[model samples]
Structure formats: structure tokens, C-alpha cells
Target chain A: MIHVVRKLFWDFEKEEQWLNEMSAKGMALTHYSWCKYVFTETPKNEYTYRIELLDNVPTHPESIAYIRFLEENGVECVSSYVRWIFLRKKSSEGAFDIYTDLESKIKHFKRINTLWNSVMWLEFIVGLANILIGVTNYFNSSSSISLVNVILGGLLILLGLVFLRAGAPIRKKIRKLQQENLIRE
Target chain B: MPESSERGALTEAVFYILLSLYTAMHGYAIMQNVKDLSHGRVDLGAGTLYGAINTLLEKNWIRAVEGEEGSRRKEYEITELGKTVIQGELIRLGELIANGKRIAGGESK
Candidate 1:
């Protein structure tokens, strides 16, 4: 039987862990889009799940080539949204790790950090613009505040703050890996 | 001296990649060859190999080979410049090993 789960994740690592946990309980992810995940019943620990951000969108030729390369290596691309890809390999096939070296791992985290940083800035700018619009509307009409605009603006800013908080641990991870690289690799 | 800027020590992944590409090989082949050559010491994950391949291509150290018609897997081979870089790296490694053996008093393997 198949099961559908609706959820959202800001942290890829946490999402991967949850997927693996589900797989360990005999639920293997069959598809994913936006915030919805489709799973099918399977033997316990049938597959290991990994989530990665590609350098390009899934439809891009470069991303296609990359996905094909991974497929050749016994890893399967199950689903993708934007530049983020969901990958899996059979548990009996041994460990599945995308970034094996310090440099690559650092680069991966930096990519994630860059994404969060950019989204945060975008949300902050849009939120501020919405607030300015609300203020202007209120002043011109000399009436009650534009409650909808203000509320929407506040929510956006709050979301931006959440993004900022999410980015801190990624930055810390990058720094830790870089420090290790200096002394070891 | 211009070439000297590019002559710095290659990362273990890059070094093994160039070595494996001396003969034409695809991404999966390169990964397998690296592991075998390193006696299973170095395992090239797919993502790492992809990034390294692109960087090597950008540097003109490796070129993609035309694969058989209808084949989706692309192959790559090391260029002359890549061969020269590895030659220099071999010499550098030789020096390091020789000095370590001479001073540290370990018998040369």
C-alpha cells in the first residue's frame, strides 16, 4: 500500500534523516513534490536517502548530465524540486555519500548557505516594500491602516528571520570543515 | 612562471582523476579505476567526481570524448597539459618520500 505525507523542511539534513527513519520502518519514498511525499510499503531499510542541491535546475542540461552520472554509479534520482534532488541507493549496496572529501563537503554547505542568505534578503526586501506601500496607502487616504498589507509584510519579515536562523548552523558547518581542511587535507 | 601558478600540489581527488583519465574513461569508470588504483583507499563519490571533472575541463587539463552514438554516458581523457602536471607532481612526491626516508630513517619501500 502507498502512503502520502504532507510536510515542509528548511533543513535538508533533517529531511534526509526523517526519510531514512521512515525507510527503516518499511516506508520507502516513491515520489515528492513541493511539501508532499508519497511512500510505498517495502522491506525495512530497503534504501538509504540523500538530499542534495544541484548547481542548476533539474531540467538543465548540466543537471541532466550530473543525474545521469549518479545513475550510472548505482544511485537513483527519485525526485527533484528546483535545484534540490532526492536520491536513494539500496541499503545492501553499502553507504551512499555524495560529497566524500572535505573540499566537496565544504562546497556543498556553502551552496546551501548561499541559498538561505539570498532568500532571506529577498524576503526582507519584499517585506519592507509591502510595509512602505501600506504606510503610503494609509497616509494618502487619511484613514485606518491597511491591516492586510501590514500583516502580510510582518509575516514575510518573520519568515525571513526564520531563514536567517536556519542559515547559522550551515555557516558553522562550513567553517568547521574549512578549519579541518587546513590542518588535515 | 605562468605555468608555475597552476603547478601547485593537486588535491588527492584531482591527482587520482588525472591519473585515471590517462586512458579515456567515463564517470563511473573513473570512479572505479581510482578506487582500484588506490587499493580501495580513495573512493570518488559521484558528486565530487562531477565537480572535479568540470573543473578539469575548464582548466583544459581534461577533455570529454565523443561517446558511441545514442550512448548517454560521456567519456573523458587527460590532455597533454594534464600529463605534464602529473609528471611534476610525481617528482614532488618523490622528493617528499626520499627526504622523509633519509631523515626519519625508515627503510625505503
Candidate 2:
């Protein structure tokens, strides 16, 4: 059972659309709280979902539209205890469990991550090396030679910035997906 | 105009995507081709790969073709524009390799 808290910042249309699509595809769901919903059935029977949608702005049209979408699609089982979506296996005789090939994919993600990390570290080392060389040249050489130090310093700074710009997002995405996989297991 | 400028304009993933589409493949096929061609060096996530495919479709570099039902997915083919980009990339890479060889004093034969 995995629970994720999502603050409803945008119009609920997107969330509503996803829920409706999932429901149309056949998944049993129950709305436990104003902010909490649960899915009892999924491709993986071992999974459950709990989401907390915080209304950042109560009067926003997006928020109202989301509430409306939920209202239009959900059926009330009891006063507030309605099952928004319900999913059950069509037949109890067949295998309902999903066998995943995600492990190998995750391993490959780790390999990409390692390569990116090494590149970033190497970039940092190269920047530091250039900076050291720049400073050494600046102090021990003529004015004309010192101009080269200025160029090297600028190049190192640009290189460091570029490496950080490219590597950070890749690292974050890989880490989040890795966490998701770990949580699922 | 310069080799680095051209290479910098296109990423390794974008390069692979364009190269794979040259043979006219589907989303899943392109993903499989990237993995196979890179010898497992690149493995794009389904979400990311699909996102890239959609972007390429919007850019008009790849067009989707109807595929048969059951086990077959929709196919995509590279457009003339896509071919031009691939051609430019090849020339850029060639120039880079040639320049590098010269700098390393291996340009003699």
C-alpha cells in the first residue's frame, strides 16, 4: 500500500481525467476521506493509493472544476463513504498477479546514473585543475601570460556551470524513480 | 558551423532518436533499437521515450503510420527534415574525428 500526498494546485481536470481513465480501464476505488482515496485493485494486487489534495486556493476555478469532476464521476455508497472507483478481477480463476521486468530497467538506470556522476566528478576535478593552473600562471608570469589565466579561469567556471546544469535534473529524476521502485518492493 | 557547435546543438539521445527513426520504426521499436544499437549504453524510460516521440511528431520530423492490430504498434518514419539533420550530424562527426586525428598527429595516411 503506497500513499502519496498531492496538493491540488491546478484544476482537478487533469487528476479527474486520470481517475476516470483508470476507472474506465477497471480499477476498484474507495474515497476514504475528503483528501484520501484508496485503490483496492490494480495491475499489481499488492498496491494501494492514498492521496491528500490540499486546496491552495479555495476559490480557484481549477479547484472547483476538480471537485465537480469528482462529483460527476463518483458514486456515493453511503453518506460520505462512497467508492469513487471499484476494481475487481473479472475472474478469480485466472492469475491476477503482474510479473514485472522493471528490475533490469532500474539496473540500467543505475548504470546511467553512475556514468553521469563520474562525468560530474571528472568535470569538477578538471575545473579545479584549470583554476590551480590559472592562479599559478597569474602570479608567476608576465602581464601577457596572465591574460591566459583569465581565459582559463573563465573557461573553468563555464565548464563547471554546464556540467551542473546538465547533471542535476538527470540525477534527481533517476533518484525519484529509484525511490518509487524501492517503495513498491 | 563549428563541430562542437553542431554537436552541442543535438544531444546523444536526440541523435539516437533521429538515427533510429531513419529506418521508419514505432515508439517501442525505436526504444528497442536505441538499446540494441548503443549495446545497452542507453536505456530510456517509457515515459521519457514516449515524450520524446510526441515532441518529434509535433516537430514534424516523424510521422506515424497505422500498424496492424495485435502485437503490432503504430509505426513512425523520418521525414526529409529529419534526414537533413542526420546528414548534418554525420558531417559534423566526421569533421570532428578528422580534426582530432590531425591534432593527435595521426593524420598521415
Candidate 3:
């Protein structure tokens, strides 16, 4: 059985955890898309999932080579969308953790934070364009479509702001790690 | 006039990884070697190992080599610069260990 679920943008970490929980309930993620996941049934707790932020272009040769390298190291590249990739390994093999120490953790979090910042900028640009179009339509045609466009543009900007805020937890974690490094020093 | 950033103190993971490359080995083999050499204490998680390998490659501390006997995986071996750095690291570690023993042994008191 394939299960479908919708997750919000801010829920990246939470959604990874939830998918693993579903694995424990006999499901493995076979496919994924923005805000949507397709999991097929499996033996309970057979796999463990991990999310890694892809800091390179997805279609780059090096990126493809790195994915192949991971496969050779026993990690299955299940699916990826934009800046994140979902990787899983058999539970019997061991944990699926990649970044174990604080320094690497900080770097990882920083990458994720960069991804969110890029997304926010993209959304803000699109929203601005939409509002400009709306204003032009209002002056040119004086139609209801202008009012609708304006509302849609405003909503997009609001969504962008929310995603910008979604980066807070990652930033907070980076700060904590830096503080620990200071203490250790 | 100045040394490279790679000449400074290496992190624990990087240190072990470079040491493991004394013999040409692939990712998984290096991970296992580090664990065994460190008496199971210095385990390299896959992600950490991956990042460390890339950084080391960028620093020219290690290079990818063809595996022996038709193996397919990318094997890595330490470069000449890596050897010099590892020697420096060992001397630093030796001094640290000596100081730690002297303080704990109460020889000065």
C-alpha cells in the first residue's frame, strides 16, 4: 500500500522523523515530491532514514558521483527534491547518521540555513513580480483580475516570510554548537 | 612567508582519516581502519567521513588512486604533503601526552 502525506516547508526535520516512524509501522519511502511523500509498505523497522542538504547542483556530475559513492558505502539514495536528499540504509547494518560531531553539525546546519535563505529570496522576487503585474492590470484594464492578482501576490510574500522564519531552529543549533566550541577551548 | 591552513592542527576525524590513508583505501575501508586503529573509539560516521575526504582532497592532502586487481571503488592514498603534516601532528600529540603524564605523575611537585 502506498501512503500519501503533505508536510509544510518548516517541517523538514519533523517530517524525516515521521517518515522513520512510519517505517517502524511497516512503510518505506519509495517516492517524494514537494510537500508530498509516497511510502510503500515494508517489514516493520527494516530501514532507517536520514536527510542531507544537497549543497551542489542536483544535475552536476560531481553530485551524481557522490551519490554513487554513497551507494557503494551501503546507503541507498531513495529520492531527492531540490536542496535535500533522502537516504536510507538497512537497520541491521547500523545507524544512518552522517554528521556526528559538533563542527560538522554546524556546517550542515549552515548549509540548510543557506538553502532557506535562497528560497526566501526567490519567493520574494516572484511575489514582487506578481504585485507589479497586478498594479499594471489595474491601471490598464480596471478589472477584477487585478484585485485577485494583488491578493495572490500578498499571500506569496507572507509564505516567504514564514519560510524565512523557518530557518530559526537551524541558526539556533549553529549558535549552540559555537558556544560549545568556545567552552571546549 | 606563511603556511597553509591545512598545516594547522587537524581535527580528530581528519587526523585519523589521513592516518588511515597511509595505505590506499576506499571510504568504507578507511572508516573501518580508523575504528580498529583507535581501538573502536574513533568511529567515522559516513557523512563525517565523506565531508572529511572532500576537504582533504581540496587541500591536496590525499589523492584518489585506481584500486588494485580491478576493484571499482575510488581508493585514496595520502600525498607527500599529507605525510609531512602527519609527522607534525604526531610530534604535537607526543608532546601533549608527555605533558599530561608529567602533570599527572606529580614529578614536579
| Candidate No. with top DockQ | 1
Q: After superposing candidate 1 on the true structure, give the runs of residues whose Cα lies further than 4 Å from its correct spot.
A: B1-5, B67-71, B105-109
Candidate whose lDDT is highest: 1
- For each candidate in turn, the interface RMSD (Å) is 1.0, 12.0, 2.3
Give the distance in Å from residue A173's predicted Cα in candidate 1 to where it truly belongs.
0.9
Q: Is candidate 1 or candidate 3 better by TM-score?
A: 1
Deviation in angstroms for A23 in model 1?
1.8
CAPRI-wise, candidate 2 is: incorrect
Worst 10 residues of 3 chain A by lDDT: A6-15
lDDT per residue for candidate 1 within B1-109, as digits (tens), equals: 1363575678999999999999998898998899899998898888998899999998888999997688778989999888888999999999988888789866545
DockQ versus reference, model 1: 0.70
Record all residue pairs in model 3 with backbone atoms less than 3 Å apart, i.e. clashing.
Answer: none
Best by TM-score: 1
Task: Sort the predicted structures by TM-score, highest score first.
Answer: 1, 3, 2
Summarize candidate 2's per-residue lDDT along A19-61 as a digit string, tens digits.
4445454444544345555543445332222222212232467
Least lDDT summed over 10 consecutive residues: which range in candidate 1 chain B? B1-10
